[model samples]
Target: MLFATEVDAPGVAALERVVLDAERAGYAFVTFPDTPRRPGIEAGVRAAYLARRTTRIGLAPTLHATTTEPFHLATQLASLDHASLGRAGWVVGATTAAEDLATVGRTGAGDGEVADVVEVARRLWDSWEDDAIIRDVATGRFLDPRKVHHVDFEGSGFSVVGPLITPRPPQGQVVVIGSDELTAVLDVALDVALVRATDVAEIATRVAAARAAGAALVFADVPASFDPSLVEGLVDGVHFHGGPPPVITASPHGATLRETLGLPRPLNRFAVTS
Candidate 1:
């Protein structure tokens, strides 16, 4: 299976070293934590910067669903996908604390609101079809207007109209990650489900439930010192909290996040089907 870890810091160089070491150690992805009051660099900004520096590891940053504008988040993520050439994922969460809401000048939101934000993000990602950008300098035409679809999304808390400023991502859609608490929202749309149980039996139960609910991948948040392979069959991957990922060996040949995760490169949603 795949392995991952979380790294957080104020210095870009330190962050880069941790990520690069993780990649060298064979971790499939590196994640950054996000919270309204979190110290250090913003996760999205760090991921974008890391995207330019690393090639194979997935660059995923935590995205708060409640406070951020869905449309902007969608575009930023699409841009990250371009920067990383397909390796992009969003660890999405709803704002829980009142302070976080206050910081964004918004009211607190629940999982339902978070789910809506995610849906809007997905809609916007697909708004600009893959071939929308035709950049045909010879014809003097830049895009096929017909290929861009208006979202016309009206959710309980927000509404968005028209095509996204960004085109569809290389992964077709950037991977959407959600925690176990939001399974109700995630089951229908998320690409990965994250669980925090350390017990093997509990982990297995969570894995079965997530799979039954239609999650394509289930990742257990493992402790730094634990061996991930022991539970490899129970879950699709292990996300460690710190340093050299336990058990999983680094790949000398190098591999992309999709390759390590065993997920195929998704066909563009706008691609013509026979």
Candidate 2:
């Protein structure tokens, strides 16, 4: 398991160096952009670039969720997963601010609704089954039309067209982690479960709940301001930590933010990160 920070904006030059260095050094993942309800387009592009440079690394936002087009988000994830050979995961959240509410031009999607969207996204990932695309230019055939599948997803707050612009992801599932607020629900239905707990007992409780919920993996988020003395007693499988860079954030490596954190790869790869 690799622990990385979720910044509010894209750190292009810094991110480039961080991700490339991590890849070169065998580090697994680097979280680049993490906007609230604004949109992850910029962050997603940067993360994709990181994916393109490395063979085995996962890219995600610490706290990223979009009220943006479901189709667009799914397509982006597919494209990234394809580029990364299925190394994409999303630590998603529900929008709460009124301003964020207006960004999607719809009512807020609470935990349940966001979870439903996640379900839709997962379904969309499977919209076009593997081997669905058979590109044979010689016969004037680019793709086997019959292979495409329209999910026909019609939800209360969102609706999506059938098949995605790309094919299915290699992993068949992207890491989906939730926060402390929705851990219980996410643990039950999500692939990747996350929580911000204060102690070993809390961590154990969350992890157990996540496992009971059938999660693929569980992660914990930590901040830099925490005292190292306080980190002595807690025992957890993994912890995620990050801030900006030395240029913008405090520690050059953000080591002060957290330690003993990991990122899960293929499954949960402990990631050393930016």
Measured against the true structure, the TM-scores of the candidates, in listed sequence, are 0.91, 0.74
* Best TM-score among the predictions, by candidate number: 1
Q: Worst ten-residue run, lDDT, model 1?
A: 250-259
Instruction: Please report, as a residue range, the 10-residue window in candidate 2 with the lowest summed lDDT.
Output: 265-274
Across 1-274, the per-residue lDDT of candidate 1 in tens digits comes to 6777888755898889888888777777888889977776778999999997987888889988877888889988889988898888898867678988888886666546777888888878887777788998999999988788887988767799958888888877888877765775433466788888789888888888888777789999877887776796788778887554454585442344555566676664444431
Clashing pairs in 1: none
Compared with the true structure, what per-residue lDDT tens digits does model 2 show for residues 156-185? 566786777777777655656566455464
Regions of candidate 1 where Cα sits further than 4 Å from its true position: 185-188, 242-244, 250-256, 265-274
